[model samples]
Target chain A: MQDLLYFVQQLINGLTIGSTYALIAIGYTMVYGIIGMINFAHGEIYMIGAYTALIAITGLTALGIVWLPLILVVALLCAMIVSSSMGWAVERVAYRPVRGKHRLIPLISAIGMSIFLQNYVHLAQGSRNIGFPALIEGGFRFGAEDSFQTSITYMQITIFATTLVCMTILSLFISRSRIGRACRAVSQDLGMANLLGIDTNRIISATFVIGAALAAVAGLLLGMYYGSIDPLFGFIAGLKAFTAAVLGGIGSIPGAMLGGLILGVAESMTSGYLSGEYKDVVSFGLLILILLFKPTGLLGKPEVEKI
Target chain B: MSTPVKKLVTAIATSIAVMGAGHATAEIKIGIAGPMTGPVAQYGDMQFSGARMAIERINADGGVMGEELVGVEYDDVCDPKQAVTIANTMVNDGVRFVVGHLCSSSTQPASDIYEDEGILMVTPASTSPEITERGYELVFRTIGLDSMQGPVAANYLISQDPESVAVIHDKQQYGEGIATAVRDTLEEGGVEVAMFEGITAGAKDFSSLVTKLRQADVDYVYYGGYHPELGLILRQARQAELDTIFMGPEGVGNKDINTIAGEAAEGLLVTLPPSFDEKEENQELVQAFEEKGEDPSGPFVLTSYTAVQLIADGIEAAESTDPFEVAEALREGTFQTPIGTVEYDSKGDMESFEFVVYEWHSDGSKTPVN
Candidate 1:
């Protein structure tokens, strides 16, 4: 009985972390969906969002603003605005000039932008890990001591709910809104979209902005959940989110969500059952296997290229 | 035209003469190498600051043999190849002494260049036992060896009478060496070794490993690696609801671990040197760090400060700026430091100071187990 409860707890923990991965993965998948280009700087934007929230909350708390919910909302908004600006700027300066060129060229440029943003953040924040205040305290107990307690925390629930709401709103906007259709048109055929009187540049820029805002939400949630933020925090999270996107289907919105959640849950189960050290090996190993077996991913649609 | 040529020649001669004079009275140069950029740049920065402080303080006190000690800083990036290149550059620049090469892999390779160049190198915090055991006369470290720290950590775990113990390492030379030592020592002491494994470093997820441990019914885990992997392990373990105690060597004593682990770090035990803040004699050093707006609780900060002091003491004792003489003096000399009395063996390793256990608190301070 105790063993069963432990398994359930581990599952919940995995799902919570998976939700964060899902959020970041959505950004990667969305950008890739439209441009057929990876936004390597997406992770750095996520890191910046966390730092932005940190600085904003620190400033607010110093002024005696102590309400937790109010601080979170304001911090999230600040993160979104800062990250969106960064995303748009990155597209204009780094991506736009070389768009429609060789595919590898833009990929290399993204890599360069990734390194540049990492160093830029390091210089701005100093090469140290800054601790963020916990958004919520105390664990949620599901049962009595003799029986078993679920051990879910308020922060975990909040992270899961926020990710679900963001993902739902994103899905709605893409499917029901005019801008969404424009984005889809661009992704389908950029030249055709231009022929149909769609502003390709505007749609691309908006895609970047929206994707970056979602990444910021992930960053903020990660900062609150882990209670720490550093300049290089994005590198690993970005890689994992990219992996999640590919695992779920690189250009599929729902696929990225499924991939992120699966990756997170798999990691949690591995850590719970195995040694914590092998969890990463298991995750990447799973990625390699999936790519080999199911190239289109679990939920991704197959794309046929014109020769 | 002849007169103009004469004027130009005279100006050139005068400039050459002044340059020669400056070279004759130039400062004594020492090289400091570490990861100036990378995840561990914090350690390098602290080292540079501490070395600079020592240089300033020593210069204010008339310097060694009336020559100002100047430091030449290089970024090794904690890579062996980069370390070798930096060592070659330092040697070419005529630096007689070196204070760095933080990681063991970097230090081991760089020490060869220092040896060939007859330049003495003193490491403040590189604790791998093999660093000095390679029979390099010019290489030395002021910290205890992993051979000592590993057993100390294992003894601490043994005292707890854990039901079962699992040991894991990051597969690096230093990480694996320390982990093996701890595992061997525990096994020799009759403790049940439930699992012994090695994992790749820089891995982001550790769920599978944690799950295996849970299945193995292990009550304690001893990890021998740096903070990155250890932090992830602690966090993931907590997330998995595993309540086992985790312990590691001094390599896991970094404040960055607390940052990465956050609340998950609470109750985790790490074997490190005694706390400098708790040492009554280190009160002044603590004040100095505070004045500089840096926390003294960081393991490397005090170690860096002590490294600077060691270099200055060597210069003073040798009464010369020559690397050979100063290194000889350092090997034989004893000095009081913030961590207490310090002395080096002929292998250029610290002969005194035993490792103690400390528990990392959620507030980022380590509490001594005593």
Candidate 2:
């Protein structure tokens, strides 16, 4: 019974964080799906989202706004809006100018842009970890009080439900929305989509905006969860999400989701049952194993390249 | 990599050297290097200010060796490679004394350059034993070594008589060193170390660790790392209702930790260089800068100030501005600084150092556990 509770609790813990990773991974996978290039700056957008919440909550509370719910709503919206705009600007400045260049050129540009945005935030907001109040607190306990307690917090529930809702809405929109079909067309063949009057520029810009918006939600959620953030949070989170994208087959939405959950569970299990020191080693090991065996990820479609 | 850019940097260096040479005869120059531009620049910024305050006070007291003390500053960004490059540049620019290169990674590498170049390096804040144990005659640290504090931490945990203790680290050099120190000491003391774990710094979640702690029913957790990771652990442990006692090294004692951990910050026991900031004798010096609208209550301020004081006093004791002479004086003499009378042994480590456990309170303050 004790072992079962521990297993269940760890499973809960994994899914809670996995949901946030999925939210961020979707941004990476969807962007890569439409554009053959990785949106390396996606992580910065997530970072900016957290910064937005930090600034918003602090500023609002200082202005005599006493209500927590109102403050949270305003902060969340501010993060989403600010991150989406920043994403749009990055695509316009970093990616658009070298759109038709060699694939490596744009990829290099993305890396550069990532560094620039990171330092820009570092310079602007100061490099020290900024800690904000948790959005919600406390948890519900499972199992007998005398036995080992398996706990789940309200914040965890909110995060899991929020990710589920976001994922559902996103999948429906992609399959049904007009802009979604255009995005699909552009991803299939950019030149052909442009010739068919699909406004490839608008579609790409929209992709960044959508991706950045989701990233903002993840960032805000993360900030609320950790109650601490620094400029470099995006660096690791971005790498992990990129790993998730690759493990999910790089450009597949469902693959990204599956990959995020698997990565999260693997990390949690490694740290829980095996060793915390080798958690990262195991995470990358999973990526390598997936790449070796499936090559296309759990839900990713195998790609064929022609010279 | 361009010729013009290279030329521009050379011109800048040459002009600064010429300017330095102009004032070289009248004033003694001390170069302070740290990460003034990186993520941990806050430490460097405080250390720089502390060094500045000490220099100002020394100059006001009619200078060391009858020569006005001068401070030269450099930014190494807390990176080891950059620190080496900066060390070389400082040597080339005629800097004979240094008070910085904040991070242990940066200091250990740069100490090589300082040693080889005959520059006396006094690190105010780097606590890794490698800084002192390297047997470099010129290398000295004002802060307590992990070797000293780690045993202190283990002894404190052993006294509590918990069911079992868990040892965790962030897997960095300092963290690993300190964790090993505590772990080894605990084992030596015949305490049950239920878990030996390492975590990645800057990771957002610690749920698995928390769950494991709960499952293990570990009564105490001795973490050897900075506050950020510990903050999350404390929070998640609270969320898991583990009620485990979270104790950490000095790296976990910070205002940011309280903010990060929220209410869970309370009851955290951390080992730190005894409460120097609260000492009545130090309050005047702390207040001197506080009056000037600068907060010098940071961990590195007094230590960095002591670094400057030691260098200045060494110059006075040696009766020369020579690096070798000053280093010899530092080894042989004890100087009274703001943190109290401090003396360096033959190895450039303090003859006796004290580490006290402090309990974190709800008001974002830490009081010594006593």
Candidate 3:
């Protein structure tokens, strides 16, 4: 019973973190889906999102707004706006100019942009890790008082709820909305869509904007959950989310979500049962195995060679 | 050229020559290097502020040996590579004395360069014993080693007579080294160490680690890392209802931990350098810091100030600006500073340094535990 409870606790822990990974992974997938290039600056966009949310929260609190829901809503909106604009600007300045060039060109440009944004934030906010106030606290505990107990905090619940709502809206947006249909057309074939009277550039920009907005949501959620923020926070997270995107199938939205959850669970389980030192090794090793065995991710479609 | 314009040029040339000669004799450049822009820059701020204050005060008191002390600052970002680069820059810039390179990893490598390049360095906060163990004649510190602090923490835990203790670290040089030291001492003291583990430094989630702690059923946990990770762990452990007592070294002693951990920060046991800022003798110095709106209570601040003071005193005692002679004088001479009486061994480590266990409160205040 104790072992089972412990396993359940690990699962809960994994799912909470995994869901956030999914949120960031969507950005990578959507960008790749439309443009066929990795937006390396996406992580910086997420970091900016976190910073914006933090600034909003701090400002609102200073203004004597003690209401939690209002604070979260405003912060989330502000983060989304800022991150979306950043994403749009990055695509315009870094990616669009070299759209038809060698893939490595945009990749290099993205790397440069990432460095620029990291330094920009570093200079603006002194390199100290500012502690984010733990606004939501307490949780439900399971099992007997003396035995091993499984615990879930209100913050974790908030993460799950927010991810679910975001995912639902994203799914609906992709499937039913007119702009969503236009996005699919552009992703299918940019030149063909352009010839068919769809505004390919606008669709591409919209994809970046939407992806960035979701990443912002993740940033705000993870920032609050972690209780701290720093300029370089996005680098490692970007790498992890990139891994998730590849593991899920680069251009598939559902694949990114699945890959993220699997990655998160793998990491937590490694930390729980084995050791935290081995968690990264295990997660990456899992990625290598998946790449070897499946080639395409679990939900990813095999690409057909162009004639 | 006209006769009057030629005379004007001659006058300007004479003043330039005079200024150049004055520069050679008027100041001794003390290189201040540390993480000016990185994650650990908070500690660097303390180091810079303290050293700068010492230089300002020393200059106001008619300068050192009738020559002004000029601090040439460099940023290492607390990275070993950056530290080495900064050390080389200091060498090329003709600096003979240095006051920093804060993290143990960065300090060790930078000190190696300083030792080889005939430069004297007194680190205010790097505590890894390996730093001084190299027997470098030029490398010194104003802080206690992890070897000293680990034993202090272990002895305290042993006194509490806990059933089991778990030791954890962030797997960096400083964190892992201190954790290993604590683990060794606890084992020697016949205490049961339920687990010794390492966590990724910047990773936010520690749920799995917290769950493992619960399963280990340890009554005490000693974390060897900076405040950010420990703060998160403290809050998570509290949320998980794990009521085990938590302890850490001075790295976890930052007041920002209060904001991160909130109420969970209360009751944290931290082994830190005795609060020199609170001492009655330091009241005036404390007032000086307050006037500038700077908090002098940070562990590194007074230690860094002492490092600068020792450098000045060493130069005076040796009666020479040569780094080698100053190094010799520092090893042999005893000087009074804000922290305490400073006397260095041949290895350039202080003969005696004190670490006190303090209980940290949620309001970002700490009271020494008797």
Candidate 4:
């Protein structure tokens, strides 16, 4: 019973973190889907989103806003707007100019954009981390009072619910919305979509916007959950989300989501049962195993050679 | 038409230029290296401000032995590779003395180059004993070792007579080393260590770790890491309603922890260098820092200032700009600084350095507990 409770506790912890990873992974998978190029700066966009949310929250507090829901709503909207603009601008400046060149060129450009954004934030905010106030606290605990217990915080619930809502909306948009249908056409074949009057460029831009907005929602959630924010906070999270994107099959939205949850659970289980020190090693090891066994990822389709 | 006259003019010009160049050579370069822009750059700000003030004051006091001390600052970002690069930069830039390379992991490698290249270094913040245990002659520090600090923390916990304790670290050189020291001491003191674990630095979540702590049922937790991770751990642990008392080393003593942990920061036990600014003799010095709108209370600031002062005094005592002479002079001489009277042993560590335990409040105030 104790072991089961512990396992459940780890699962809850993993899912909370994994849900945020899924949100960030969508950005990577979407960009890869439309342009067939990895947007390395996607992580920076997420970080910018978090910073914007924090700034908005601080601003709201200074303006004597005491309502919790209103504060969170305004902050989320601000983060999404700022991050969407940043994503669009990054695509215009970094990815668009170098597109259709050597595949590595845009990849390198994305990397350059990532570095530029990191340094830009570092200078603006100073290198030190600032604390994110925990607006929502407390949680539900299970099990006997004297024995080991499983617990979940309100913050974790917020993260999980927000990700679910975002993913659901994203799924519906992709399946039923006009712009979403155009996005699918563009991702399927950019040249063919252009020939078919799909406006591939606008579709690509919209994909970036959608991905950035989701990442911003994650930024706000994770920032509050973590209780701190720094300029370099996005770098490691970005790498992990990229790994999730690869694990889920690049360009597959559902794949990214599943991959993120699997990776997070694996990490938490390793930390809980084996050792906390081996959690990262386990996660990365899982990535390598998936790449070796199923090179296209668990859900990714095999690439077809162009005639 | 006038070859002899032109030759005379050239000689006169050359002699004046030589005289000017000779006069410019009277300045001694003191290299100040640390994390100018990185996660731990807050500590670097303290290091820089302390060393800068020392240099400014020494210069204002008619310079050291009629030679002006000039500080050359470098940013290592608290990274070992970057510290090595900064060390080489110092070597090539003609820097004979250095005051930092803040993190123990960064300091250890940078000190090797300083030893090999015949440069004198005195770190004010690094506390890992391995740095001084290597029998390096030119390496010195104005801070206590983790060996001293760990025992101080352990003895305090033992006094409280906790039923069980959990020791945690960030798995870095400084963090793990101190955790090991604390664990060993607690064991010797007949305390049951419920768990000893390592966590990844820069990781945001600690819910699993907090759950483990609860499962262990420890009454106290001694975390050996910086403020950021510990802050999150504290906040999360509080949210989980784990009633364990927490303690940490000087690495987690930053005021920013208050912001990160919120009310959870209250009652945190931190072992830091003695509050030198509170001493009677340091009032004027503290006032000087206040005049410049700098806080003199940080553990590293006064120690870094003392590092520079020791370097200047060492040069005067040796009466030579050679690092070897200054190092020998430092080893042999005893000088009074803001922290205390300093005397180096054979390993270049202080003969006696005190680590004081303080109870930290959420309002960014700390009161000495032991």
RMSD of each: 4.8, 5.0, 2.7, 4.1
Best by lDDT: 4
Candidate 3 — which residues are off by over 4 angstroms? Answer: B1-24
User: What is the per-residue lDDT of model 3 for residues A1-307, given as tens digits with 9 covering 90 to 100?
Assistant: 9999999999998998899989999999999888899999988899999999999999999999999999999999999999999999999999999998999999999999999999999989877778887788888988998888888889999999999999999999999999999999988888899999998889999999999999999999999888888898898889889889889998999999999999999999999998999999988898899899988888888888877
Show where candidate 1 strays beyond 4 Å. A139-150, A305-307, B1-21, B35-42, B76-85, B116-118, B165-176, B193-223, B226-248, B252-268, B275-346, B359-368
Q: Give lDDT tens digits, candidate 4, residues B119-227.
A: 9999999999999999998999999999999999999999999988999999999999999999999999999998999999888888888878887889899999899
Clash totals in order: 20, 0, 0, 0
Residues A53-91, model 2: lDDT tens digits: 889999998899978789988998999999999999999
Maximum-DockQ candidate: 4
Between candidates 3 and 4, the lDDT winner: 4
lDDT of 4 at A238: 94
- Distance (Å) between predicted and true CA of B130, model 1? 2.3
Residue B62 in model 4: shift from native, Å? 1.1
lDDT of 1 by residue, B1-370 (tens): 6999999999999999999976886587768889887666767776777666667667788876777778789999777899999899997899888888788878989999899889988886688888898788778776777899899998888888877799989888788888989999899988998888877666544645665666566879999887777887887678657788899887777767777777888988989877666688878767876787866766666676677677778878988767788888888988987767788888888877678999878666777785
lDDT of 1 at A237: 92
TM-score of each: 0.85, 0.93, 0.95, 0.96
Least well predicted 10-residue stretch by lDDT in candidate 3 chain B:
B35-44
Sort every candidate by DockQ, greatest first: 4, 3, 2, 1
Question: Deviation in angstroms for A257 in model 1?
Answer: 1.7
Q: Which consecutive 10 residues in model 1 chain A have the weakest lDDT in total?
A: A141-150
Candidate 3 clashing pairs, residues 3+ apart or interchain: none
Query: Order of all candidates by TM-score, from best down to worst?
Result: 4, 3, 2, 1
